[model samples]
Target: MHDTKVTTDVMNPDCIVIGYNEIDFAEHARRKRAEKGKSGGYHDLLTNSVLLGGERRTYMDLLNIVRERTTGCPSRLSAFELPSLGVAYLTSFLRRRGFSAAPVNSFNSATEQLREMLAGSPRAVAITTTYYVYDEPIQQIVRFVREQNPDVPIIVGGPRIQNLCSDQSPESRDGRLRPLGADIYINSTQGEDTLAAVLAALRDKGGDLSRTPNLIYRDPAAPDGPMLHTLTTVENNDLDENAVDWSYFDPSYYAPTAYMRTSRSCSFGCAFCNYPALAGPLNLSDLSTIEKELRYLCDHGVRNLIFVDDTFNVPLPRFKKICRMMIENKFDLKWISFFRCSNADDEAFDLMAEAGCTAVFLGIESGDQRILKNMTKFAKTDRYEYGIRELTRRGIATLASIIVGFPGETEESVKNTVAFLNRTQPTFYNVMLYYHDVLAPIENQREKYGIVGSGYAWRHSTMSWQEATDWKDYLVRNVNGPALMPGYGLSLWTLPYLLANGMTMEETVEFIKGASRLVIKGLDTDYLDPEPEIEEILRGLAAVRDGAGQGASS
Candidate 1:
């Protein structure tokens, strides 16, 4: 742990950005029970199981908890991983510009912390808010800064703010939907432009805000309460390498490895996702620029790199270019990134594996074609299976993501998902409870998929759109079988992967056989009542057994 530097009445820094960091994992556990209508005891049981079970905690459960809590209860809180990336990038970007910037987690004493930072007579403050849980804290932070130093400019950005800004136009009231507290609202796409403009303005003691992209502000002296600016959208490869200052920002804040975003935005517009809306179309940074960035990290001793791109494998040619550059440079680093299952092919998989790609997180979405089509995933079940198997055969590990409780989800659909996952057998999986956003732009045209009730209130304990669907019962009834939903079951499946990865080949096979048998037998007898159907399916998993058995036999 890095020791906190204590300074008495320290001069206010130039800028302070508040990032809502991860609270303890227990709070999320409690939220899950609240959303599921499970008893209080259930929370303790889960917390105990995860905290005490040690090796028993599965990736599926972690993802499920994230989805259920973020969806069912409209809190701005998110899993610790994503926000850490955003903070690292932003902090690094700011420090490179010669600005004293530090990313502070919201778990600390926020008010006092702000007061301490502002003591330096800083020029401005920026804070991030996600869709579900951050509105209130961000608003409060804005208000606190305003009350303390009325002239200090405050900027807000994140998925929630970006969506709100994107929906705003001459004819729409979406801009007004945002809390009136912020001096500026920035969309996600123009993060660098907006931050740079804000920094420039602060240095000059304020200037015309019109030049800033993806910003909205209010001038009390003018009749119009607020004015919005044209947002700047950069090309995929247009990242400003010189704009980032690395001195004040620390890369050591991350675990496993440092995080980097090789590209911005997503090409696919899955109806349930907000990325296309918030990020505004797919864009890739130039391969040379990405190579430069990767080399910089490697030179700086960053051995693990996690690309934060929503769809890393899209624009197959560009992806191949990146792979080639990585291999050519001999960038001795291991990386993990997300990919659309439909877009990956044998060549791409081979290149990635050769370049030391450790894992690829695939957004498999759902196993049912109808549900997938409804979600606009645009890929068939067969394609997904082929991709997973190919990746596995090539010795590159895979993490499949699945969504459950979507509008068209049914008992049969959930079962099919589990069966599909069982057949493909990725090394790891993540199951997300469905989250319906009525506030999303397409909600009016897609009301059937829109979440009902007062939608989720960010940062507050309230019912979210997914909760309106009675998802717990739906999941319990429809996805209750022994085979986990392709997405949901991955959590539990990862435990064996983790154990196996740490062992020798022979030991790994033995571990898998013993675990698989125990799991199969548990499923067979009705002893594990919650997953009986899964047990029945396991009885038919002779192929899976043979695969595991062969490795052991060899």
Candidate 2:
């Protein structure tokens, strides 16, 4: 941790902000194959493991290692096209406060480039750690930052920070925060105010953090011990004031797909989710504000938009008005959003497609009514069927997201989920293992369900965590596997990037399906170099992306 210094220059920058992008395994695998060739440890391990009776644990262990080492791996798709909107939001907020901020592109760039940027020696370096909870990449990033600027303050904040400090014990929270190797950690739900206060204190008061609430930092006086400064979260009500400054982004480093959020939190509180708690409350952007942002995005050449709203279709009136606004403006843009299957009117679906909604992500957690009730997911299974069918008839793609294990998961429920997927025929579907969190509402009923352990290692009365994982893999192998897209089972947000990069919906589905087949084959054989096949598919897609680019330029 760095000490408080009086060397901040307002003209240079208040700080340099960066965000971690998720690793695209297909891209990672392709890079590894190029660097190591087809005859490396990765291939040898798989071949040897298969010859010696394939051990699933060994294969999984290797994959985990690959995920850890694949940090800083650039992607032509996710990295450049889908940059972190969280970083953009914070940077825009800081700039609005008259604090010059340099937003670093950590997605498609390397750490050494960050080292070059640190030559400016800004007041502090802020890193956004959200989405996946994997800390290995974060640890690597923190180490790189220290190497670049030994004495500069490092501030970490995001939804993931809330998860890291969720434990009531100070020691546990300190243990987690300290390992990230940052001078300051923001543990607030909404961090705009907390972060702004931190910057102001660091700059004007020589890093006096007493005024900054919701922070974990080492006291300047007591250098040996870390201190927690806690307070009630002050939510940001006026989101309209902070429009993203597109000037901070490099057009060459980004694609035409832009991510926008029309709301702050979800209206419903599902038992297994902690987002509602983290986001404070549900606050919708005014329709005027939404239109202004939409116009600004169009001016910046955004041909496609992805609304990162928790529930975009809720408070149905607002949803209808937004759709009508896009239609009235005649903006040449396609969009997508998360939709609740219930309480939706038939006219809404027609308006959605007419307003250029190419896709909708349905969080249909389960097709079993028993599991839905257990999850407090108010919507019925039948409503989900109707919603998907309605979207399908209107030519809108439906990505049905499924969770394998909740408190009451059973084989019968899993069967029901599979049957529902088969019947609805969603354009895409993904099954994920339940991520158990002690802070989630479901924790209140842990004893009733006989829940034990935490995170991906948890178990309940009905099944163990391993059973859930195995069931997840089974669903991937069977449940409409041939029809649904593959390469994006983990990251559904990347689908819009494909559409923006000049791939037709049919072409995108066919391309990902080809990759999905190899994935399924690997599961069946337990041994095979599908990465080489995956690399070929990516190469083809890259050509299409490039060809589209050349044509546009012409």
Candidate 3:
């Protein structure tokens, strides 16, 4: 890590914030190992991953790889998109403030452009690391930046720092960010409003941090130690006001569909969730502003939209108003939204489809009542059935996001959930393996949830990783096969493009199920190199997902 230096005015004092991600097989395998808090030989990780079998590259991806190889040529098997909407707003706010700010948007763009931008030696380089797999790679990037330009203020933000703040002390916050090389840690509030204040502070010679909240400063006097500066709470709710520099983003950089968020946070206090801890509570964007955005997207020939709301169906009035507006405007755009079963009445689902929704994603955490109650999910399997079935009956495709290994999950619970899936047959399903965050309510209620172990090694009261993995494997083989959407189980993220381009809902689901999706993001440089070994690894995992091989633990 580099020594902390206060912001100095060396002229224009620009900031180039970048984000680095990995979808390459080797890089992805390394990240998976890091996430498990385990380290071993590279080949060993690949072998173990094939045996243990987490959600990975879809079966069709492997088939495509093999087919291309036989033709004596290779191409990129897939593409991954990390839209980094947070970074967009942050940099946009800086630009609007008269500071020279550049957003190196995508992972691919960062890799190719960051070094050059750094060579110019901007006043500061800012970036966001949003996921567990991103931490190490981002750390390496930050370290490299420090080596080249020791004086520049490196601002880092995102969930990793927030997770580190669980220690609940200023010194701990200081200590936690040392591993990362950021000069200022935006650990508290991530609103563009908050970041703009921080940026303005840093640009001033004295480095005024008075207006910032949840900020950890690097005091050169302390060097290795941090001086956590706690400021009064600031409501950074102007999220919808910030506009992205569309010139920085090329539609071709990501999937065919356009993405936007209508709001932040969910009202629910589900034990297993980290949403409230991260984003606080629901902060809806102005409905009038959203309508203008919808019209703009429509004017631009944008045909597919994805609503990234934490709970798009909640707060029934705003939800209904948005739906009514979409209907009134008669947007030709086909869209998909994340919905909770509690607010999913038949009338809502029916109105949603008439308003241009082609698919609805439901977070059906489990089919077992006990597991649902264990997490304070508030909604039960019967409720999931009604909402999902209503969408299915209404010709609106449904995708159920399922999770295994909740604190009280059991063999019977797995069996019951699988039975429920078999009976309902939602258009598709997203099977997630549970990982506990230190800040989540569930972690605090260890006894309440029967959580065992501690930190990264923890497990639920009755469930072991091996047991959960095996059960997850069983569910894939029996319940999910052949029901997935084609071409990477792109799910709602890319399904609108597929539908708009001509694929039917049934055709889309066919691609999503039966496929073990590759977890990392992919790029367009992107031509798949025919790695028969990679294909063979995928085939081996497919056999296990198809119930042919014993899991890694066995």
C-alpha displacement of 416 in model 2, angstroms?
Answer: 1.0
Give the winner by lDDT. 2
Error of model 1, residue 475, in angstroms = 6.4
Task: Rate residue 115 of model 2 by lDDT.
Answer: 67
Residue 16, model 2: lDDT of: 76
TM-score of each: 0.67, 0.83, 0.79
lDDT by residue for model 3 (1-554), tens: 00111132222346775654544444565455565433122212221122113333444355345435545666333223434555555555676677666666554545545555666758777777754433666676677777767777888776667677755676666666777767787765454555666767766746767556767777766766547575746455565675444333444432345677778778888887777767876788888878887776676566778888888987887888899998889887778888887776777877888888887777788889998888888887888888877887878877777776778889899899899888888877766666676667887888776777643355666886656665766666567432533222244566665555444554344333323332221211122333434555445434544442254346
lDDT ranking from best candidate downward: 2, 3, 1
Clash totals for all candidate models: 27, 0, 21
- At residue 258, candidate 1 shows an lDDT of 57
Against the reference, the lDDT scores of all candidates come to 0.56, 0.70, 0.62
True lDDT of residue 410, candidate 2: 94
Clashing pairs in 2: none
TM-score of candidate 2 to 2 decimals: 0.83
